[model samples]
Target: MAPKVLVVLTSQDKFPANGNPTGWYLPEFAHPYEVLKDKTELVIASPNGGEAPLDPGSAKAFENDPISAKFLKENKSLWTNTQKLADILPRVAEFDAIFYVGGHGPMYDLHSDANSLVLIQEFAEAKKPIAAVCHGPTVLIKAKSTSGEPILSGASVTGFSNTEEDQAGLSSVMPFMLEDELTRVTGGRYVKAAQPWGEKVVVSKVAGSGSTLITGQNPASATGVGKEILKALGL
Candidate 1:
C-alpha cells in the first residue's frame, strides 16, 4: 500500500491583531506538496475544514517559483476543500506521517488548538513521522507527549527564526517568537542555519516514542523537510 500522509494547513485567514490576511504560506505547502504528492497518499486538512486561505504575501513573493505557481493554478480545490482536523483525528492511525505547513496563520491557530495537540500526540505515540516547516512548528509549542512533557523538549529542531520574523516586520504582532519558544521547549536544543532565511533542516527522534520530528528553518527549507520525511519513512 502506498504510504499515507496527512498534510495540515492553518484555517486562519487573518491576523487577530490587525485583521491582516494570513494563512498557509504558498511555497511552504506547495514545495513540500510537490515533493511528496507523487510518492504518497496525501490528505489535506485544516482546523476548520474548508477554505484554507493563502497568504497573499507568500503568493506574490513566490509567484515565480514554478512548483508553487503550478500548485496554485491546479490544486486550489485541495486546500479550499480541506478536511476538518477534528474529523481526521478519529482515523489518525491510517496515516504514516503528519506534516504541518507553515505561515503566520499557524501562530494564531494551530499553536494552541486542542485538536492539533491531540493529533500530534497520537502520531507521536504511534511512532509515526511528524514534520513541519517555518511557522508550522508553532503547533509543536503546546503539543505534549504521553508523559505530559512538551513534545519538542530536548529534540533538535528548527523553524522560522526571530530574525526572520523581525525582518518580515511583524514580530510585534506575533503572539510569541517561534525561535524563542522552540528554544525554550527544546532546552536550547533548537538549531538553525548560519544566516537568517537560510535553509536548515533538523531531524530528531522523540525521546520516549522514537517518533521522528523533522523541521525546517524557513520557506527555503520546505523542500528539504519533505525529502527528509520521505527518508524517515524509508521511501
Candidate 2:
C-alpha cells in the first residue's frame, strides 16, 4: 500500500468583511498537490467542507502557467469533493504525514480552532511529519506538545512574514501577526530567511531527532517545501 498524506485547508472565504483580498493562493496548494499526486494517496479536507476560495489575483496572474492552468481545470472537482475535516476525524497514526496549505484564510480559521488542534496533536504524537507553508503555520498557534509546551517551541520554523503581510497590505487587519506570535511561542529563537515574499524553506529537526516539521516562507516556497517533506519522509 502507498503512504497516505492528509492536506488541510482553511474554509474561510471573506476576510473580516472589510479586509483586503485574502484567501488561499493557487500555487501554494497546487504545487504540493501535484508533487504528492504520483507517490501518495492524498486527501483534501476543509474546515467547513465547501467552496475553498482561490485568491483571484493568483489565479488571474498565473492562469497561463502549466501547473496553474491544470489546477484551474480541476479546481472545482478537487475542492468541491473535498472531505470535511470533522467527518474524517483523522488519527495521525493512521497516515504518514499531514500538510497544511496556507492562504489568508488560515489566519482566520486555523488558529485556535479545536478541530485543527486535534489534528495537530494527533500527528505530532504519532511522530509523523507535519508540514506547513506560508500563513499555514498559523495553525500551530493552538497546538500543544504532549508536554503542554507550544508545539512550535524549540523547533526552527518559518512562515508568512510580517513583511509579506505588509506587502499584501494586510498588516493592519490580520487579527494576529505570524512573526510576533511565532517568536513569542518559540522564545525568540526561531529562524527565518530573506524577506517575507522570498522563497525559503526551513526543515527543523523536532525534538532534536531526525523527525522534522518543515515550513515554507511563502507561496513561492511550495514546491521546495514539498520536496523537503518528501526528503524528510525518505520518499
Candidate 3:
C-alpha cells in the first residue's frame, strides 16, 4: 500500500489586523501535491474541516505555473471539503506523515491551535515524518516533543525568512516573523537559502524520537520538501 500523508492546510482566510485576505499559498500546496499525489495517498485537512482558503496573491503570482494552475483548476474539492484536524487526530496512526502547507494564514491560526500541537506531538512520538514549508513552520513553534522540549529544539530547520517576509511587504502584518521564531525554538539552527525566496529545504531528526522533520524556506522549496518527505518515508 502507498504511504498515507495527512496534508494540513490553513482555514484562516483573512488577516486579523488588516482583514486582508490570506490563506494557504497556492504554490506551496499545489507544487508539493503534484510531487506526492501519485506516490502516496493524501488526505487534505484543516482546523475547521472545510473550505481551506487560497491566498489570492499566490494564485495570481503563480498563475502561469503549469502544475499550480492545473491543481487550482482540478483540486478545488480537496480544499473545499477538508477533514477537520481534530477528527484526524484520533486516526493519526493511519498516516505515514503529516505535511503543513503554509501561508500567512498559519501564523494566525495553526500556530496556537491546540489540536494542531497535539497532533504534531503524536506524530513525533510515533516517529512519523513531519513536514512544513514557509509560514507552515509557525505551527511547530508551540509544539512540544514527548520529552517536553520544543519540537524544534536542536533540530536544523528552515522556513520563510524575514527577508522574504519584508520583501513581500507583509512584515508588519504577520503576527511574528517566522525566521525569528524558528531560530528561537531551534536554538539558532534555523537555516535558510543564501538569497531571499531561493529554494532551501532542511531535513532533520526530532531530538528524542528521531522522527524526520522536513522544512522548506519558502514556496520555491515546496517541491523539495515533498521530495524529502518521500525520501524519509522510503517511498
User: What is the TM-score of candidate 3?
Assistant: 0.99
Q: Per-residue alpha-carbon lDDT of model 1 for 67-133, expressed as tens digits?
A: 9999989999989899999999899989999999999999998999999999999999999999999
Per-residue error for 144 in candidate 2, Å, reads 0.2
Give candidate 3 regions above 4 Å deviation. none
lDDT of 3 at 137: 92
Runs off by more than 4 Å, candidate 2: 17-21, 90-92, 207-211
Q: In model 3, which range of ten residues has the least summed lDDT?
A: 145-154
In angstroms, the error of model 3 at 107 is 0.2
- Tens-digit lDDT string for candidate 3 (36-131): 999999999999998999999999999999999999999899899999998998898899999999989999999999999999999999999999
RMSD of each: 0.7, 1.9, 0.7
Structural similarity to truth (TM-score) of each candidate: 0.98, 0.92, 0.99
Q: Given candidate 2, what's the lDDT at residue 233?
A: 70
